[model samples]
Target: MNGPGCAAGFRHHTRYARSMSGNRKRILIVGGGYVGLVTALRLQKLLRRQLKRGEVEIVVVDPRSFMTYQPFLPEASAGSLEPRHVVVPLRRVLDKCDVRTARVTRIDHARRIATLAPHVGDPYDLRYDELVVGVGAVPRTLPIPGLAEFGIGFKTIEEAIGLRNRVLDKLDEADALPYSDPRFRELRARLLTFVFVGGGFAGVEALAELEDMARDACRLYNEVKREDMRWVLVEAAGKIIPEFGEELSDYTRQRLEERGIEVKLNTRLESCVNGHIVLSDGTEFDADTLVWTAGVKPNPMLRDTDLPLGPKGHVVCLPTLQVKDTPHAWAAGDCAQVPDLAKGPGAYCPPTAQHGVRQAKHLARNIQRVMQGKPPTPFKHKNKGAVAGLGLHKGVANLLGWIHLKGWPAWFVHRTYHLYAVPTLNRKVRTVVDWTLALFFRREIVSLGTLHSPREEFAEVAAESAPQPEAASRTPGQPVPKAGAPKAG
Candidate 1:
């Protein structure tokens, strides 16, 4: 439960009081996400002397204790990589800073205080001289019927694992029944029908990788055939993988369709209640699984604060990544509408890992400059390229907005780029090892669905073997005491 940089115990507001001797300034970084982790690490390196002398204290608060390298999530779910290698523990990485597992409920900039609700214990106010908002975004959802109950989002590792387990579990269930049985026909059709909404990178890559896994897994099931499964991708847009341009997007769609995936363009999912999918084009089907990766919206926590937000509910930030009209507040990553100076006026940086990492570097330097009583520099950068993998040894890419590549070369670029981009050398080495071993061995197809409810079997056995209460000692065949009256007195 404890790690380096973690305090031993909790206290009231007094815990954030400045040291009587040095009067150090406290910098509270909200959200242990891509931007927050990078910013905190860079700040620690920049303020090493101040940290040792107690002249500066860096505190990072997030609901999760680790930062997930999201790019590798699809591969993780496909069992081509280890899930644990895709996340880095904040406390271990930031040994000099404080990493608190808590949610920042509100920020009162006027009072220089932030309200934090920890995983345990009471809520408290922590005073800070500087604040960095990087709470990140959540899945953008619509008011579609049954979406909340039936649809899954491909945002986190847990969701990816759950999807993998659920898919495999369905396959296992379908295998137990004879194909000729009526129940088998219905169950197999429903179980193998997977629907994915959205045409973006997350949705496309997830569908591709999972489809690859499912096809490979079919070889192990005697009753299941790869052609029997149906994979559907519905996008309201005109094309998928818009980041890679029209050529690559078309190529990506063609590749998916060649693999028997139904790529429905300009089609919206009207409803998916009770596994019944109704599309805008009047197409109807039953699919037990539906993945929603339509888009992402800024963290709703910004609504609780007084920070100025843009039209889309993202924090309004200047070119310098400083919150508009607030001197001490700063924001970046998906939560901030950062001006894209490279694209000129009216253009903001896209919310991607590349921009988030770059913004963190700039934000750290700017914070240090402000601390030294110097002016901050504006953040300016242009997108370099984009890459997307389509299963094993297949992909599409566009480099520097000029060079386009597809198939094996793009796949290599996708892996090479992400392997280098994922944070931490330890994780990088582990992931590479996973890939190396995978080359020599087949992909692991075993599903540990029981991990979701490890106690279910034991609970069932306990209930079944539990001693039955003695029946009422009455005449044999006497009507079982059907009344709430005094135990058949």
Candidate 2:
């Protein structure tokens, strides 16, 4: 039978025998995000004997050395959860698989080769029998003025940590300036104003969590009051958190407004040039911080590959998660367009961690079936529910598309779900410990903004201490110094 081991367009029996006789078949997985990490781990478990006997090998490549549990990012940004605990070190966790910290520049499935660019050293090509494209999406940005220069995204652990420090640093800046100073009003106004564009889970959660933390943090600042802080959320859609259904969405908006946060629905951010925020509603303000979590697009690397892509630039794949028109090639996660059987004809699964996790498991099993010369089963799973943590002890959830939950109960569910979902027992324990300690202790509000440019001070010192050429020698008419002459100090 023609199977994954047998390359398409080739003689199956001969190729299968050659594959079996040669060195272990290599499975190269790209983009070590949720999908890539899970697939590699699952494959390692399923092919334990093959891996040990050198019958099969797996290699995972990603830019980052770790896989971040993105759901906890808002909490990490607000200091409710430790940032380090939100990420799983790929090398530490995937001991059985070869995890390379590199970026895949291009992939040539026809030639069974991929070009990798490591952080240090030259780029190299790797050959593989099977390829899994799990490279996740990148932030979808627009041509808004000054956005590229100012907007911050809430996607990675570093971004979360940097955001936390930035917020606190703004408070410090506001405090340092005297009220009587001419620039104080404008500086304080700008420093205290924070704008978040996007009504999705990432934007809302980040806004709510940071607002909660900032409000609480004000208690420690003599000059800064919670009332002085201006928080705004701008969404082009009429509602926020639409995934939580209409009622809960309204409730979330109401709760946010009640907290003095300006929720501008059906509004768009027209521009943010030089920290000045202009909205479609004609409202204008100066904000030191502008966070953009509007949306995400599939990784652009898909275009550089031999794989077929959907109209939206996602890797086109069958329900079985195998790349279309290609045997022994598969894809899943935000990068792949997997047909959603549960959603009926012409529907594709939404890019989400839930779907990615399930797809990874199914992808592994289907590959195993292909290896055993069995027909691959299609991947199908119903959407269970979505939970959103609005702030401390405040949340909303939609369960099974029928049951709606709000308040503390929803918050509990939100935390409980993520606590269980974050990969690795070690991370789970660390996250729980952070929450437990937070129950009794206040959140850390200290700003480590200098960490962003830790070398600045050293650079300044070096510039000050560096030897200068004598003034006369530097003059236009002056003669050059002799090689053996005493140097002019």
Candidate 3:
């Protein structure tokens, strides 16, 4: 699609050639994720002149209709932004590209064919002249018993909404019953006893925001006290936010402790049996909520593919972002292990969103060059450092080169960078509005508990009131003794 906002024009079906007698090649891209969208969008613009050849077609396949900007997810969960704004619709942004909302079940580079699992119905095969694999990462889950059944993963927009609903509903359950009821108090504590694993960006921000929200909500409940609830963060490492350096980790730890959150460093989640969470440290905790954000591995789709893979299951891409020796195929994002040319140490770039975005732009340019028979340039980006949000208007950041920031300044950077990075003007404005509204309005403290079981309570009552033929037969006004009459006579 061509637009004023777009850097260049993009058309998908047609191929670019110098003459009308064009033998156009087809480009097949996998995973309509962040890296995939950017690569396709950039190629459409860079190779606009090429698509006019009417020979080459570009096909993008993925399960999601939209690409979610994950950094804004915490704010979305915290009610700091509307949920809808965090996702960018695939069809609206990539014009002229054949966007297929399907999963790529298998890829055979040896034969240059990809098998696609359609969103519904039958599966089909798509043969392409070139292939791009940008299948992003998935949640890294352990084999701990009840991990999948009892615990929730903090990935994607769906899980974010689920967490919010579950949290509010638990609060409502606590408040609905009389304060004197033990079940009511136990439920209230269970609701607030939320546990999060992993101390990375996802774990820290989620823990802090939810902790802040819960602490504020305690003001509204007469029985639920701030001290009564527990917020535990379990990290296998010795410190939280290791990217923030030693001092910042200490600072964050202090900040959380002040908020009454317990940080369990050098710990592991052993099991979650019947919501009773046992730790490697021999500590046991019974929680109604458990969130796992330990880490992530590349999508398993790469395992069966013919492309070369790294030790971590990431695609082996050259400095040019092309699959090693395969000039036609390219990859990026968490799924690709692109080498850092500048370092000269043969080190792979970290699996981070920063690297992913940078690689996408480079890959876009290289694809354009490849389509035009021009030599592709290699990708080399300097480390830009890292930043993290600890809680509302508070954070820590390591700026470009080596400058470290903390308190409000770091928080400002965190907000500014994320707000700028959040795709589309509509989402940006809506997020600002959510924050502004929060300044004036009281935090929405009312939890809609009935949403969990709108009918179960009534069903229980109905079952109790249901008529019993045995009881009715024995009632004073009921006829009974017909069979026994002959015997009595």
Candidate 4:
């Protein structure tokens, strides 16, 4: 609720009352992440001027006021892009819609009410004539012995930037200590070792780019060498990059191995007790950073609601995006398991950003159709391709079939597609600028440790240099007056 360091916060209830004239039919939206923000924007554009006729009002609720461009996160953490550019202000962009920086704690489909926990105020229930469930997914973490306390999830922009700083900070700390001391050197070696647990896009791309960045960064350090840093990517599955199919996954593994990254397969992290990575195969290594991006599950809030869910806790919907056997209720994004008509089997659309974006547009039209007393259209989409950037000018991609691509071309497609798809033109320009600058300049690895405590350095310096009681009023290089004497005056 302490809104992710975006523009502070605004209380929209008072402002919205002024817009209400107390009659527009309300649309209450939950979860203002990617799916929520896009859906609300489309609804606002579609339901324009209806408020004047008291026909429609839209309210969106989320814990934060920003929608994170998740795809750019790995690049941002690797210093390829600025962290600020990856997050868009939801309230500023969706001003016409009532936006609340609150999280929905519970939902009641039968009563059409959503219980929410606002950023500052007490719990309250919002009633709406129409509803949308875009409440996205969270990082699927396991109950590893010490994971909860030591592991970091790559979800929010803050977390991404924090991870970047934390990673770079470890480097700074390790190198700060003299390498002549064995204990200090061992600590430095451990800090430089990074462990990534997952073989999916998040894990692969993150491990690849972050490793690339750290390798490049080591040149600046006096004693730290690229060989001293160990990047271990652990996958429980047999291969990496499942989107690329088995052969390409093998290619990915080979590419990582060529770069001296250890790709451990059929492996599980036994324990990270005291920041040491103990493996299931009796392999042990000391690591200071552990990243978790393995997978995602549907929002658990669905269990308490009356809406019917599929096998995986997803809201069971027909071809149309409407809730099964329910009226005026809808769910999409990762939360609803919309049946994939294209797959021919009982396949539901996999929760990917590509599908989520497409579904949002169709959903908007469907909602508009339903509002106008027309039948809603079914949601169906065929995936064209999947691409991932694995550092500055390296990657592997599968466009249609097993048509594999690696190196510069794959990386370019990854950037170009994400640049076009990420939200507003302002953000698009910023992302372009990030890439453009990448061409002429070197990526900076300096960590601004002041972010953790801006005043600690100043406080320490002040304590070290502060004048004694007898010299409190003295000027630099000037003789201090004695406590009881007139002194130099």
* Worst 10 contiguous positions by lDDT, candidate 3: 9-18
At residue 149, give the lDDT of candidate 4. Answer: 84
Global lDDT of each model?
Answer: 0.90, 0.90, 0.80, 0.83
Q: Which 10-residue window in model 2 sums to the lowest lDDT?
A: 5-14
- The local distance difference test score of model 4 is 0.83
Q: On residues 371-449, what C-alpha lDDT tens digit does candidate 1 reach at each position?
A: 9999999999999899988898888889999999889999999999998888778888998999999999999898898
Candidates' TM-scores?
0.93, 0.91, 0.85, 0.89
Could you give the candidate ranking by TM-score, starting with the highest?
Answer: 1, 2, 4, 3
Clashes of each: 0, 0, 6, 0
* Residue 478 Cα positional deviation in candidate 1, in Å, after optimal superposition: 25
Give me the candidate number with maximum TM-score: 1
Candidate 3 per-residue lDDT over residues 98-130, each given as its tens digit: 788988988888788788765555555667778
Residue 56 in model 3: shift from native, Å? 3.7
Candidate RMSDs in Å, in order, are: 4.7, 7.0, 8.2, 5.5
Q: Model 4 over residues 224-268: C-alpha lDDT tens digits?
A: 778878899999888887878877778889989999999999998
